[model samples]
Structure formats: C-alpha cells, structure tokens
Target chain A: MDPSEVDVPPLKDLTIDNITDNVKLINSQCPDPRLKYLLERLVQHVHDFARETRLSHNEWLAAIQFLTAVGQICTDVRQEFILLSDILGLSLLVDSIDHPKPADSTEGTVLGPFHTHDAHSEPNGTQIAHDPDGEPCLVLCTIKDRSGKPVSDVKIDIWETDSKGKYDVQYEGREQPDQRAVMHSDEEGKFWFKAIVPVPYPIPHDGPVGKLLKLLKRHCYRPSHMHFMFEKEGFDHLITALYLRGDPYETSDAVFGVKESLLIDLGTVNAEQAKTYGVKEGTKTIVYDFVLVSEEDSRKLREAKAMAAMKHLGLRMKLYNGLPVPEID
Target chain B: MDPSEVDVPPLKDLTIDNITDNVKLINSQCPDPRLKYLLERLVQHVHDFARETRLSHNEWLAAIQFLTAVGQICTDVRQEFILLSDILGLSLLVDSIDHPKPADSTEGTVLGPFHTHDAHSEPNGTQIAHDPDGEPCLVLCTIKDRSGKPVSDVKIDIWETDSKGKYDVQYEGREQPDQRAVMHSDEEGKFWFKAIVPVPYPIPHDGPVGKLLKLLKRHCYRPSHMHFMFEKEGFDHLITALYLRGDPYETSDAVFGVKESLLIDLGTVNAEQAKTYGVKEGTKTIVYDFVLVSEEDSRKLREAKAMAAMKHLGLRMKLYNGLPVPEID
Candidate 1:
C-alpha cells in the first residue's frame, strides 16, 4: 500500500508527548483489527516505559546490544530467546493465559525449549533410565476425565533430568533417548514406567540471558520436575509437569513453573511392593492421577476467559471502534 | 550467586496475577539501586503489556522469533536493532530525553544508522558529490554559540543521500564516499560544501524491521534530510539533521527526525552567484546556521530534566526506597 494513500492525517513536529500518538495514528492503518490493537497497546507501554524510566541513550543502546547478542547465540539445538523468556517469567505467564484450566483439572506449565520429537515409543512397563548416575524410580499414573471416568489410549510423553540434572538432549552425543519416553495408557487408563528421579537444574546461562540474570542477581535454577505432555482425540492437549515436593529450589524456581497442586511426594517401596511395581527394592515410586478437560468444555472456558480479557481491553477497542477505514482503491 | 544464598523470599505457586511481582522480588537482589529500579519498572511494563494484550502462546512465540531475526540480521556495518528502534520512535525519544535544548539552541535528532567513520576529510567549499546522476548543490553553513558569537574550529561532519535517495554505504563495493565529508569550521565560524540534493527515500525495507512496517501498514520513507554532527571544546556535541521543506514525507518522517525549526528551503543560484559560491550556474543553494550550547549549560538543563523525570517516576522509587535490602554474607 502506498503511504500517500494511507488514511492517517499528516503528522508534523512530533515531540516526546506527541510522537506516540502520531505513531499510533500511522499504525492504526493496519487492516487487521487484532494486530492494530496489539500494536497500539505495545507502543503505548514501551513509550510509557521509556518516559517513566528516563532511559538514557547509553542504557537503551545497551539493551539493544544485549538483545542482539541473545539472537545471535540462538541455534537449532539451542533457543536462547525462549530461555530468555523463560527466565523473565513470560513463558509461564503466557502458558497460564493461553491454557486456563478448571480447578479439578491438571494445571499446565511451560513446555520449555528442551522437548524434542525423537523420544522412543515404548510399552508402559519399559525402563527409560540409562544413566548409571541416576537412581531408578517407578511412575504409576492414571488418566481420567473430569467426572473420574477412565480415558484410555491417552498418549503420554514423559521426560526428566537424571540425578545430575541433565536431559538426554543436553548430552553432546552417544545417546539413544535416555530418561524420556512416549507411551499409551492401558484400557483401564493406567500407565507405568521406570525412570530416574528428576533433579533441580540450572538453565543454560552462558548466553546473554545468563548475563542478565547475573546482573539482576537472580539464580537460573529450576526446581526438580518431570515433564509430561498428554494428547487424546477429544480432550484438550495438555502440556504440564510434576514438581517434586521438598526440593530446595521449589520455592524459587527460576522459570516460575512450580505449582502447589502439581507437587507430589516421592515414596520408597519395600521389596515386595517394589517387585509388584516392577522396579528394584530401593527404587522410588509415585502414583498420580491426571484429569483432562474435553474439547467442548475447553472451548467454553476459553470463550469466558476471552470475554473477561476483552472487557479489560475494552477502552482501547472502544477508542478505535469509531476509526474510519480509509477508502482504498 | 547461589539461589540459596540470595536473600529474596521463597516464591511458590506463581500464578499470572503474581508472576510479575515474583520476578521483581527475584530481581530486587540486584546490588545496584539504579539497576534494580530499572529492572523492576521494565518487568512491570513488559508483563503489563503481555497481560493487557492477552498475548497468546503463538503470538508470544512470533514476537520471540521476530526479535531473534532482527538480532541475527545485524552485522558490523549494519545495525538492524537500531533501525527497529528508529522506526518505533524509540531512537528519537532517547535523543530528545538525553539532549534537551534551550529555545534558542538548535534541537538534536536521531543519529541514523547510515553514518560512517570513513568519510573523506576535506577543506571548506570542496565538492563531495561524486554521483553524476545527482543534481549539484552548494551548502553554506555557519556555526555559532548560543550567544550568537562565531564558534570557530568546530568539527562538522555532513552526509546526505544522492538524488535517488541512496547513501554511499548502501551500495556494494563502493570505494570512496560520495556526498559525505568531514570538515572543520573556519576562524570566522563559517564552512561550506557542495553535494547532491537529497530526495525523500524509503528506509531499508528488505529486513525484519521492514516487514514489521509493512505489517503495521506504515510507509518506510523518511523525509529528505541532510545529516550533520557538530562538536567542539566546552560545547555539547550536537547530532542533528535538516529536513527540506515541502517534501512529501516531511510531516511523517519514518524516523521522526523532522522538527519544524530544522526545516530548510532550497534556492536557485544565478551564474554570478554560482561562480561566487564556486559552483555551476544551475546549482541549488542552502544557507543555514547552527547554534550550540556550552557543556556547563547542557549539564544544568539535563539536571533539571532529570529532576522532572524523576518526579514522574517518583512513585515507583518511593515504593522501592523503603524496601529492605536483604543482608547477605
């Protein structure tokens, strides 16, 4: 589209007070209402931030250079941007906003940058732990609907760090997927596997995001948690994790992925009980049940949440609702 | 620093409502009071932006990817981040905040990304134009202190685009600088040069920032302007540009660099006038004067501005001022 043909009024002599308004005026030409609204609010917040902070040229340039370094460091195996977001708490915030769940439903958390598509598919009783340094554990879980009915054939993907707090992907080479597996629930909505207990780990801190954490004087350690993803034909796809109770970093998780409801206690089993669960006598065990929300139910809840969010944003929408679409040829 | 060593409170079950506060709490460990304040405010604004916009997971990922691309595209000679800042009005906003001027003093504008340190140094009245396709023009300029006294020996750097709106640096494999020169003011506080007439041109639009502009329906053209930088002992270094009057984009400069007081008009010169100015008969002419402020004066104004800006930000500082700094061993 030609600029001269834009419907925005001519803007002249933009000072600090007026520049934001002029910017909004020009960007208001965007044909998509949602994008236009997003840009308008984004500009307002950033401009207000600059004004309120009295951000100096040097400081602003420092931010620019920092962000540039963060982008430059990103590779296929490493996503420095997502790590940056995770550290900033934006990743969790977005997860909460996008996937609001019912009180009884299993809570969702950050899908973090480490999840990959290459995990081995296995039966429920298969052992996923291959690291000698890790202690063995048995995971027994049941998948159920909101009304507590069994939901069979649910695809459950589980991954975790070893005793030393490293995932399989973190290793440079010499690895079939260890400490991670994908399995299907039985007819009674049951799934069980043997793996290493997860340990608290620090996020990748050798990049620009790490530098920022150091400057902020914050640690980059996430509490020990097992990653889980659930998919079924009629249920809302779930991306979540289970945090271990009594972990030292639980209260101060770097990514803010910890939830009280998601916390579970690890139990030790006697020889007979361990044999029945199919793990060694010294192995740790956890028995947990996950509740899923149906697609129709998820849609209804999302519509309600979206309505509330729209009301919160109604003022800006109302202001632009009257804007005339420029006559375009 | 170890997470256990930090004196921040234990944050548990961080919901969307409390994630921002938790982030600030963690970041409050910053020893530097000013940096702590900046991070606190930055987190507040960004988190607020995300919440207020109801930013979705996919949208957030898009933003992350866009920023990564912008950072990845930057090189030693080209700064895509600065370009992004420029088009967003952030560069100009920083310039205005950092360099406040008295009413009689010349205003400062954004130092755009096209500037280079490799311009040829030349004597007064030397023709800097090398492009045969460009129209010849004589630029006469005088520099003075705010008191109207000639300020001799001022370092003046001037650069402008050719008639086609392309800078020398934009061309690949160019050996010599065209229409750009670095010169000093004479004892009489006078300097002159010959260059091609600048034309309104689109900013580099083949990059991520350009894609953003296109998405926002904003035209990427900046008004025709001549870039200038002036520096001398005891005076505030000035980075500014002159916008030609009546340019189609003058009112809507892409970088928001146009100010009413900085607008200039082009004049036609006769054969005798051209000969006196050491230019051809049909040459265009621009005669302008620049005023500079003393360093001491600049400091005073800056202090005043800083105080005002602080008052604008006083609420946040006040909230944090009483915050107890956690005792650390």
Candidate 2:
C-alpha cells in the first residue's frame, strides 16, 4: 500500500505533529518486510513517547550518552545492557512472555550474566563447595514429565554465590570454579548435591548500570537463589532459579526474577538424617520437584497464544500488493 | 505527592502490563523534581512503545547494538548521532519546537555539522572562494528588525560547499578553511560576498548513520544551500539556510531542514552589474533579506506559549506536602 495514502501530515516542514509520518516514510523503505513492520512500529512509538514527554534536547543528549557508556563498558565477560534490562524488569518480562509454561510445568526466569559453558560435571551428592568456611547444605531435586513419570538422564546445571555472597567468577585471583556443578539425574529422576546455602548478593555495581541504580535510589541486592538449568532430549529447556523463602531481598529482588512457585522452604535436618544425604548433622536440606513439557507442545502453545493476542489487539496478517502488511490498531 | 499513591500497577512479578509501573518506580527516585517528572513521562512512553510493537528480545538487542555503533563512531569532528537524529527528522522537530519565530521574521533551520566557531572574519564583498576552478557568484543580503529598521553591525557567519559539492573540511589534504567567511552588516544593514554557487552534496556516508540510510533505501543528499548564522547585541540569534530554488534535492532534503520562505532565486547578472559587485560577467547574484525579533520579546513570547500549553495539557504548578509537584496528564 502507498504509505502516503494513510492520513498523515506533510513530510516537508516537519514538526512534532508530522514527525511520526516522516519516520514512517523512512521505515517504509526497508527491504525486509518484517524489518519494515518492526521499524515502523518502533518509529511510531518512539516519536509518540518524545511528544508525550515533550522531551528536551538535553534529556535526549543525556540518554544518548548513557547508552554509549553502557555499550563501551561491555565486553565478552560483561553484558551491562542485559543488566540494565534486568534491573528495569524488561528482561524478566520478555522471559515470561517467551516461556509461558503449563500449570504443572516449571516456570522460567532470566539466564543472568554469569552462566558459562564450562561447569564441571560431578557425581550425585558430591560436594560443590570447596571452601570449608561455608555452611553445609544438602540439595535434593527430582525431574518429571507432564505424565508424572520420572525423566531420567536429564542434565541439571546449578550455580550460586557462597555464604559471603560472592560468586566464584567474581573473585579476581581465583582460577578455578567454586560452588557450582553440573549433574545428571539418576534412574529415579533424582539428583543430590552438597554445597553451601546460597546468600543474597549485590550485582556488580561499578559499571553504568550500577551508576543508574544509585541514581534511582535503589539497592542492587538480589535475593538468595540457586540458578538451575534443566535440559533433556525431548523436553523444553528451562532456565530458572529456586529462591529461599525467608531471604530479606526476596520481595524486592533487584532483577525481579522471582515467582510465587519458585520460592521453596529450606528445612533443618539433624545429624542422623544429614548422614543419609552425606552431609554433617544440622545441615539445611532443600527438596523440590520440576516438571517439563514436551518441546513440540511448548512451541505449539506459544504460537497459539501469540496469535490469539495479536488478533485481540486488532492486528491482522495480510498481503498488500506483494508487501507484507500488518494492520495494527 | 507520593508516587506510590498514583494509579499504577505493582512492579513485582512485572509483566508487560506492569512494565510502565516499574519504569515509574525508577523515575520516582530521581532527586531533581524536573528530572523525575521528565523521566516518568519518558518511561511511560518508552514502555508503551515497546508494548505496542511487541518488541522481541532479539530486536531489542539489534537496536542496542546499532546505537552503540553510532556512539562509537562519533568524534570531535564527527557527530554520527546528530546525523542520525537529523535524518530521522527529530533534530528539525526539536528545532521548530524550540524556535517559534514571529510571522514577519525569517524562519530557522538546522545548523548542520559543517559549522565551525573559527570562521575567518572578512571585509564586505570579500571573495570567499579561493579555488580558481569554481563558478563565481555574488551575494547581497540585508538585515532588519520587525519594525523595518536596518540592524547595523550584525554579525553573519556564512558557509557553503564548493562547486564540486565538497566542503573545505571534507578534503583530506586541505589544511586551511575554504568557502567560509564571517562578515558584519553595513549602515544600511547590507552584507555582500563573492563565492561559488553551492552544489547539492551527500552527507558523509561511511558511518553508521549512512549505513542506516542505505538500509532504509534512502539517499543521503542534502539540497544545495548557503548556511547563515546572524547575531546582534539586542536581537535573538538566528541560524538558518538559504536554499537555491531549483535544486533537484530541494524537495527531498535528507535532513528535512527546508522551509518555504527560505527558498530564494539566484538570478544571472550582466558583466557591468557583476563588475560593480566585483565578480565576472554572467555571474549569479542572490538578493535576500532577514528580520530578527528582540531577544527580550522572543523570550517572553516563548515562555508564555509554553505556559499556556502546559496548562492546556492538564499540568499544574503547585506544592504537594511542601515539595514542588507538576501534575501532568
């Protein structure tokens, strides 16, 4: 369709009233149909936002500088933009939208910035905490399919900060990984590990994201939680965290990665009971179960939901003279 | 006023529905009241834009990367972000909003990237074009106040590209500034200069902004025009351009800085008239007039208009619990 056919002000002598139209004109020239659509929508929104706030030139300059700093500070090991997104709750929002689980399945959260592909594989019930100064804790988790059947041979990667609230990666002098491990579920779909109870920690705040948090008068503490990634051949992958029930930051997690179902209680077990789990007496024990949905079912559900939402929003999929046209309200 | 008391969704377990609330929460922590208000409005608009487009994680990543590239490419002599803004028509939009001139006064346009603070001061009718290959043109301009009285001793900084459409700064081997001169108006408010007629030229296209233009299927040509910055002790400063009437790119100026009143005809002059103006026979001569408003009057009018607009938008200036509160719609 001719973009000019739409009701828009003249591009010449452009003012705030016609800024969106001028942007749309540029967007219409994009070679890729999907890119064109996305750019057009982006232009409309950005222009509207500027007009609504009557954004000053100085404010816009500040934003540009802030974004530039965020980009310049980023490296292979550091992703400040992602951190910015997480703190603003955008990362979690996107995660939830992209991974809507069934009622009985595990919910997903942010992958965070610390995950690595080199987690050391360990045997069941092996101790992951090499530092003896940490408090001993025993973790036992089960994995199951939607039918309540055990899902064997599944990989579970777990990582967390130590009792002092420092991840192994955060240490400048450390050369080896600490307090993290990868384990395979047993025939019974059960895996056990001995480690220190994870502690609440602040995200690295020396960067632009940290500066932004300080400016916002907000703290950078995330609730104590164990990061878990579960994967198998036929099931959908899950990147989530198990939060301790009583952590002070649980309700005010800086990244907002918490969900009601992800919070679990850690019970104290006596020596005799702990001995059975290969840990000392008075150790904390966490027992939790995770359910997985089939990959095919998950994909179908996501597509169906997205389609319904688009329809509800008055968007239609149609072709206009060989161009893909998204009729949006 | 207490921000929490405002009608907003909870930030916890933030979904797209609560994204704006989370943004507002961050905005509320701003120490400056004006900053707080601006940030809140910005958050609302940005969040709305994201939701309206249903922006994906990958799309967001692409945008972040694009902005980073634009920032990284900027230097003391180069401003890719400003170019991006100009091409997107945002710069012109902001200029128009900030400078609302009276009907009788000359309109303003973009200052562009070619302006420098070190233009060489020259006498009346000085030849600015040192290159012997260029076509000689004579320029005569008059400056006056809204009352039709001549405004003497007004400084006018004039700059333009050479006949080949290359600015002196664009040359890699050139060491001295070319085709630029600063002059003052005579007792009759008349200023004259001899230079080459500027040719339409393309903006620097090797940078990220250029790449974006190509991706948008748009050219990078700006219409041939002479930039002028007029300043007087008691009058508001004016930055504008005088466009050659028949340039092919006049209607499609890449920066959208053109206004109807800025277009002027360059007439051919005979040898006698050209010699009188100290140029060769068959030389082109441009005659134009500019009017300025008093600085004090301009400031008062601008402030009054802004106040009225703010009032009409349901924004009020009041104190809430001893703190300044701007109630915006």
Candidate 3:
C-alpha cells in the first residue's frame, strides 16, 4: 500500500527493550480479534525465546536455513514439517489439547504423515493384508459411546505397517493400499478385520528432520501400532492409534505418542473364539473397545480445558486496550 | 540401531502435563551442551505458546502450511525466510543483539535480502545510476573507528532503490547491476559516489509474507534508505543503512530497521560542493560518517552482552546435570 494509506501510530524508536511492544501495537489494527490476539502472543513468546537464549546471529541463521530445508523437502506424500512436529511432540500436544475426552473415552494420539483417503471399503472380517508379509492378526473391535450405547455405522479407516516395518506408501511404485481399509461397525457396534501384525519402524529420517534427530542422538522409530480414524454423525472425529504391548520401542517411542490408556495387549485366539471371529485357530488377535464422546461434549470439554489453561497462565479472556504482558519470571 | 541398543531412562506414559519434560529428558542425551540448551528453551517457548493461546487444530495446520509455502518459495536470488524474519522484526533484533555499538559508533540494521555479490567495482565519485529514472544524489562518507582514527581501504558495497521504490534485482530478466556498486575508502578514509535518490518502497508483497502483512493491516513499505555493508581487516563487518528523515514510512518501516541514530537529512549540494563531489550542480547530497568497531571489541561486547542476558534470564554459564527451567511468569 502507499505509505500515506497506512494507519500507523507514532512508533517509538525500536530497541531490544521495546521492539516486541512496538510490533504488537502496529498489529493491533487487525480486524479479527482472535488473529490479533494470536499474533500478539506469538510475537511475545518468540521474542522472549530469542532474548532469553541470547540467540546468536549464526544460530538464528542456522535456524532459518534449517526451517527452509524442512520446507523444501516436503512433497506430495512426505510432510517433513509434520515429522518435525511429531518428533518434537507438538502433534500429540495439539491433539490432546483439542480432543480432551472423559476418562472412559478413548484417548487421541499423533496422526503420523502416512494416512491416505483412497483405501477401499471392505466387509467385516475381510483380510486387509494384500502383501502376505507378516503374521496374520484378527482385530475385533466395538464402538460405543460413554453411556454404553452402540454407535453403529461409524466409518473406521484402519492402517498399519507390514512385518518389514514399512507402510505401503513407503514403498516405491505403490499402486494400491495394503494392510489398510475402510470398514463400518454393525448395528451391534462390532467390527472385525484381518491384518498383519505391525512392526516398529523408524520414521523417514533421510531429510533435514532426520539429520536433526541424529544430532540430538535420538532414534526415529515409533512403536508398532494400528492407526484408526473414525467419522460418524453426531460424534467427534477420532484420530487415534492402538500400540501393541511389548514392542521394542513401546516405552521409547520417538514421537512420544505412547500413552498408558492407548496401549493394548496382543493375544492368541483360542479355537472357539477364532471360529466366532471367523479367523483360524491360534491366530494372533487384538480385542479393544473404542469409547467415543459426542461432538457437543467434546467441544465443551475443549473449551473448558482452554479456559482453565488460560487461567493457569494468567491470560485474560476479554480484549483490552492492550494485551497484558505475560510475566516472565 | 536396535531398540535395545538405544539408551533410555525409565519411561513414563506421556500426558499433556508431562510431555514437555519427557521430550527434554529424551533429548538430554545430546552430546553438545549448547545445542541441548537451545533445543530445551525452544521447545519450552513453543509449547507454552501453543498452550497459552489454546492454538486450535486448524490454526496449527494453517501455521504449518504457511511456513511450508514460505520455504518452498525461496530461491537462489530470493530468501523468503530472511524476509519473513525482517517483517517479524527478528532480523533487526538479531542485529541489535549481535552488534551492540557504543554511543559514538554507527548502529547496525537489517542486511535486507537484496544484497548481491556481483556488484562491479567502481571508482570513487562514479555515478551508479545506469537508468535515467530518478533524481541524482551524491553520497559523501568517511570510515572511522571509535577513537576517530581514519580507517582506510574499507570495502563498501552500496545499494539503494530508485525513485520508483524498486531495486534492480526486483526487475525481471535483469542483467548487470544498477544503482549498486562496490567502492573503497581511500587513505584519507573518504569516499564519494553519485547515485539516484532512493524512494520509499514496499517489500515484495505478492508472496506469503505479503499476505501476512495485509492480514495484520500493515503496509509493506520500508522508508527510503541506502544500504551500506563494510568489510575491512581487523574491523567488525558492519551492515547498516541511512534512512531519510520525513519519509512517510520513516517511523513505520516494515522491517523495524529505522534506528534514531541512523536517520539523516537530505540537502542540496551547492555548485562548489557539487564540483568537489564531481556531480552536477543542485544535486541532492547525503553526508554521513561510518564508524566501525574492531573485531576484538565487537566479540568482547557480544560475549559480555550474552552473558548478562543469560544471567538475567536465569540461564547457567556452565553445563549442569540439566538445564534450569526458564520461569514463565
């Protein structure tokens, strides 16, 4: 815009001591209060981080280049930034903040970068393992609400890695989904599917995020788990994973995605139970119940949690002439 | 490496309340103590920002996509990240932190993204205006140290915008540089050059950074200024600019680079003075001195300033068992 068209306050001589305030003041004209608030808080925290760390010029440049590399490496299927966020535990943190559920409801976790929408819908008890690379496992699951009412017709997108510790998308020239499918729960809120036992595998570490992990002396592996994304009318969209017991990386999942409530045990199905599940005797099996919360309840819980956090942080709920400076002890 | 080969402390089921600590714990194994400290501080500040603002899932996704676009748009000639830093006031902040000058020394500012290494070396007093697009201006300057000692042979790379508020680099299919050149201070520490009067110009606004500025209700124009970068043996590399007083955007420079000390008035050179500067009569003139600090002095000052900031922020000087958590009041 032409300089004359800009509405600016009398700007103070920007110094280290006042630059943050100056930026906030200039940006106060944003029409969206929420955006203005977010920008203000963002500037405050980032500036504080720089000041507190006494970030050197070289270090700052390195960070810029690092982020650039992270961004440049992203492709249609690979999202290095999400991987970076996952390794830093931000993805899970955001999920937890957005999806706080009741004690009985299933907990949420990181939705890693491999999920795809092209999985073909299949019948219950149909085997999703097209590669035949891992031991067959029967997954028997029930979906219900907190009040123990069956929630039928919940569309569940299930995916997992093969015994080779890789998803179908990770392989070159992959044309169709393997060990992944879309299924629906019956009127009884029950669903059964056959899949290969997933194995622990390292996240894609050949890019900048991988280099960072190496520098931090960290492994990039995530624990073996089955990804489940549920979509149903009147229910909160659920993105979660069920981690298997005794996986090598179970306790040290690189993405910090493991939660005690989300961990389930793997068992061998007896002859009678195998017949009922429509699987062979002695097949590996997983049995777990997914307790979902209603969309209204989820939204209310999130708002309450957000308010409590704001209070804990001493933030105001309403806008004022200027935002109160967050105290830095 | 195998999971068993990876060294880990006892694992705890990660919860929102404990995730930050767990991430730090896992990353504490980093061999480099400084990197470890920086990472810890970065995680703390970012996580705090997310929590305090109750950053929504949509907001987080938006941020990720914005950053990715910023990175993807960078090229050999364009540094969108540095531009991002400039608009955010981080570029100037880093300059201030790294180059803390004394009262008598020339203050430093942003080394904006338009600088190039291909500037042709030109004789003193040579006119660099290849295009007859703007009014002529003569720049007369001397290089000196803090003690008023003349510092000779200082290589100065000078650049500025045309009256149209655009740099040569901004033009499509540009060839040789114009309105920019590399000159050197003589034995008397004096140098003069004839160039066009730079006009206030908007930073590139067709990209994501531009979109952000528009969102913040900010004008992307930086006040009229001439960029100067100096390099000399035994002296600090100085990157600074001289802003014209009374420019409409002087106080609201998009990059926050307008320091009080860096503002200079434009005057008309009389016939006699124009002859000395080898410019036509009534040419606009800018008279300013460049004061530089020695390499040793600059390093000492930066180190002391960093030490003090660390102390003020409650950071430790030496490595400890673990970094002290920064207080967030």
Candidate 4:
C-alpha cells in the first residue's frame, strides 16, 4: 500500500456497513436449496435498490398507504384490481401462454367476473323467465363447422341481465330468476329462442372497489350484453358475450368484453315472421351463426353431453369431452 | 376476408339502417386494433387449459386464496412473502438479468424489508451501547481497496441488538437508541468499537403477518448479528449483515437472512490487546473486516432499488467531508 495514500474510510462507509451485515444474516436462514439461492439474490437486489435510491421513511409509508387502499377496494362482487389485471394484459397473457388455441376457431374472449357456473339448463327453445323487458327480439342461429356443414345436436348455455341491468342471480326481492336459460340444438344444429335486447348497465357501485374508482377518477359501466357457452362432440368449447351495437357503452364497456365478430345486426323484421316464430313475425330479429372449432377428443365430448344429461349432480362431468377432429376423407 | 369464405360485406353492404351497420363503430369504441386479436388468442388457450386439467372451482378458488395470503404477510418489519419470492428464485432471477454486478465486486444478495434509512453517525472508535451488562469486545476493522490498499478516514455505521436480541428501537418504553451507532473510520481506514458479542434473536410476532405464520405452523426467529452499510466513491456501496456462525437461530431465521461468506469467527483475544485498546485487557473481542464492490451509481442499480428508497424520505443521510476514491492501483 502507498504511504502517500493513508487509508481513510468516510462516514458513508459506516452507513453502508450498518445495513449490509444484517442483510447477510437474514438471508443465511433460507433452507430450501432453490429458495436459498433465490433469497440471497433477492436480498442483494433489494438492499442495493434501497441504497441506490436513497429511500426515505415517509415515502415508504406512502407506498404502504397506496397498497392498503388497494386492499380496501377488493370484495367478492367487485375486483377492481382484477380488472386492472385485464387492462394490463397480464390475465390474458398468462392464459394465452398456458392455453394456445388452434388457428381456425371462433376465438375466445375474456370471461368477465360476473359469470356463475350454476345456470339452470333448459330444453331446446325454452324461455327461462320473465322479469323486466326491452326490445323483444328473436335469435335465429345455426351451428356449423369451418366447412359450412351443420354440427348436429349441440348444447348452448345462455344467460343475460334484465333490461334494468340486473342479472337473475345478482338481485333478490320480488320475483324469479329472470333473463336466463340453457338450450340444446336439434338434429340440424339449429335453434331459435325468445328474448329482449339487453340494456347497458353500470357495475355494482355499492362497494370499496367502486369507491376506489371514484378516487381514481374512472368509470364503472358495462355495455349491454348476453353471455353464451357452447360445446359439442369433437369441437372446442367456447365462452363469449354478445353486445348490443347501438349502446353507448359499446366502446368503454368497463369490463372490456366487446369484439367486432360477436356483434349481430338486429334488423327490424315485419310482424309476420315474429308471429311464426312465436314472437309477432317481422318484429325486430337478429340472425347469426355459431361456428365451432375441432379438437382432439370426441369421447370427452360424449362425456360432456352426458354431463349435460345429469343436471341433478350440480353439473358434474364424469369425464371431459375434448374437441372432435373431422373424419378427413 | 376471403371472397369464398364467410362473405366480407363491402362498405356499401354496411348501411345506417341501424347503428350496427356503422363500420366505424367496430374501430372506435373498440379503439385498440390489436385488443381483439390478443384476447382471441389468449382466452381460447385459458379455456382449453382449464378443460384439459378438468380444473374444479374449488381448486381455482384455493389458488387465488393462496396468492392473497402471500400478499397479506408483508409489512415494514417482516416480509415473509418477499422470502417466498426469494425462495421461488424469482428475485434472484430478476437480479441476474438487471444488475450483473461488476465482476470482482462484493457478491450481492437479497435485501429483506426491515432496513432503516438513517442511523446515528458517531466518530471513529465510538462505543455502541448494546446493553448495560454484557461481555466487552473490541471490533477492530479496516476497509481496503481491491489492490489491498486501505480507505483512510471513512466512517462505519454500526447497530446490533443486545445479548438478548433486542435493538434499542425495538425495546418497549425504551428511551434512547441502543447498540446502534453511525461511526467514522480513521485515517488508517481502521475502526474500533466496544460491545459484547450479540446473541441470536427472534423476529417480532405480534402482527397480522405473524398470525399468518402461526396458522401456517412455522417458527419465527433470526440469528444474532450486526448490520453494516459500506460505501465509497469510485466503488459500489454495499448493504450487508454478518451472521454469527454459532447462533441457535442460525438455521431457522424467519426472514431467511444468512450466508456463509458473511459469517465471522469472533475468536478469543488476549488481555494485552484489550488493554492496548482501552479496557483491562480481560474483555473478549470480535474482529472482522468489511468488503465492498466497485460501481458507478447505487441508485440505478435496479428498479427495485428506486422503489425501496422512494418508500421513505425522512430517513437521514450523514454527509462526510468528501468521498475520495481509495487507491486500489
């Protein structure tokens, strides 16, 4: 060592030692081989990060406050943070990385937080209930393959909110479960149902998540829509919601559930066809076709079909029916 | 958009008969052009994965519950979830990518959450009052450069719990800070302090974070030790803690802070050296040296560094005369 450079440690040196040593001791307790390596690495980064930023106590406290607010806003019915997750694209990102779909399919979208699996399955074209009302419309739809062939005898689980923006399960007071049903297609993969065009509604604002939105200066409204789940032998099962086009919430639909492909044209039909279809014919009618994508397992489909039969079991499936492949000729 | 496939209606085909016919509606409210494509690819995968695993509602709920529990376990003093992050190897994985510490520098590790920004900065060789009664030991240490040259006149911040594992700040009804002090190094890059060997201690157990560990059936303790944060210009500032090799809690620290490299021997010393220093020379002494790595800036070391520092502000920073680079060459 050069005598000209007499060793001189500064006050900062002492400050550094006060922290580095404890960090070393705490990290040493890790036993999980993987965890130990991870702890050591994390501790170093955390400590270094702290020192670099010259972090202060009050700033740390503010962070704690932000997190506490985030917690206060969460509830069983409203998960603003989860919606935040959707916006950040993390939920869908994780979902995609884990479940890549085939190229030719009716592309799946988000399963908004409002869905409950316990919907009552009804017979083909059976109406679930009547509560509130909107523009009465007829659903004239067919199920088909990519090749345009009819997929016979498919199942469609359907549910929607009443015109007042309330679901059958979300409200409780005067009446029965309104605006909900499950339907099965006939031999030609065709079915028609009676319903009213949905009305857009705001999310439940009676919770902490709602309060948080107010604090953040954001909105909590969703576009009017109906939910559907479709499955059949040898084809992919899909979950999606159909949105009303004219609704102002069509763009900033709060839950981010809109897609161009799912919007159907509910053109005014003459009163004649509405009556023939049980509704007054020529009344407003929306017509669209559902397309199913092929999958790897047909036996799973048969099992799903069977599970649909055993509704008393709370919708339990004895086995999973995978997508059925085409019989390539 | 193929002509032979499902017909792609021309702009003319889309009319204003109803708002649904407006082509601009598809692009505006759903303003993000890429959103549909992304969600389409993601949701299909998520649903298929759920089907493949036959994932049940109960299992899914449990998974979400576990994540919530992890978040609930974090606090200023205890960060079990951070340990979980460490053990999961995510922290180190991030550290590896972000701060590739300059080779030949202090090996970095994870920074557990209980760091304080400002500590008492005392003169070189100041005695830190650990407790009124305990064995006397002299900490003789020198901070040196990479070329074995000493850093003259640098300060070392020192803090350690009493023999019973209690820092002055942690004791109930305590009047003044105990055992912890900010001290400067002499011109010879050397420092000496009087204290008893610190004994192992348990972490605090009276908070929600603690209640969680009890429910999980895990123990809560940390090995006895001292904290040190070493810094100098033309070098990276390091935050580290040394682990007492033989402490009872060595293997079971709840915060997971421990490392073989940071452990010290605290071997027995004779009366002559003790007398030479100050005491009757019969006092026990534990001597150790701190090693720091070189770097450009400590703040930008990692993203988390900025986060931890900004967490608090009023924490103190003790300025020195000036930071002169130690002559390593």
**The best candidate in terms of lDDT:** 3
Candidate 3 is graded, for docking, as medium
Candidate 2, TM-score vs. the true structure? 0.80
Interface RMSD, every prediction, one decimal place = 3.4, 5.9, 2.7, 17.1
> Chain A vs. true chain A, TM-score per candidate?
0.89, 0.88, 0.93, 0.63
Per-residue lDDT of model 2, residues A203-247, tens digit only: 878888888777666678788899999989888788899999878
Q: Write the per-residue lDDT of candidate 2 for residues B287-308, one digit (tens) a residue.
A: 8999988987776655555555
Looking at candidate 2 chain A, the ten consecutive residues that score lowest on lDDT are A1-10
Clash count, candidate 2: 1
Docking class of 4: incorrect
Tens digits of per-residue lDDT for model 3, A247-309: 888888888888888888898889898768777898888888999999999987887777677
lDDT of candidates 1 onward, in order: 0.82, 0.75, 0.84, 0.51
> In candidate 3, which residue pairs clash?
A327-B329
Candidate order, DockQ descending? 3, 1, 2, 4
Q: Between which residue pairs do clashes occur in model 1?
A: none
**Model 2 residue A259 lDDT score:** 80
DockQ, computed on Cα atoms, for candidate 4:
0.06
* Weakest 10 consecutive residues of candidate 3 chain A by summed lDDT: A320-329
**What's the C-alpha lDDT at position B48 in model 3?**
82
Among all windows of ten consecutive residues in candidate 2 chain B, which has the lowest summed lDDT?
Answer: B1-10
Docking class of 2: acceptable
Task: Point out the higher-scoring one by DockQ: 2 or 4.
Answer: 2
By TM-score: ranked, best first: 3, 1, 2, 4
User: In DockQ terms, which candidate is top?
Assistant: 3
List residue ranges in candidate 4 displaced over 4 A.
A1-81, A88-240, A245-329, B1-63, B73-81, B92-105, B125-138, B152-179, B192-224, B246-259, B276-284, B297-329
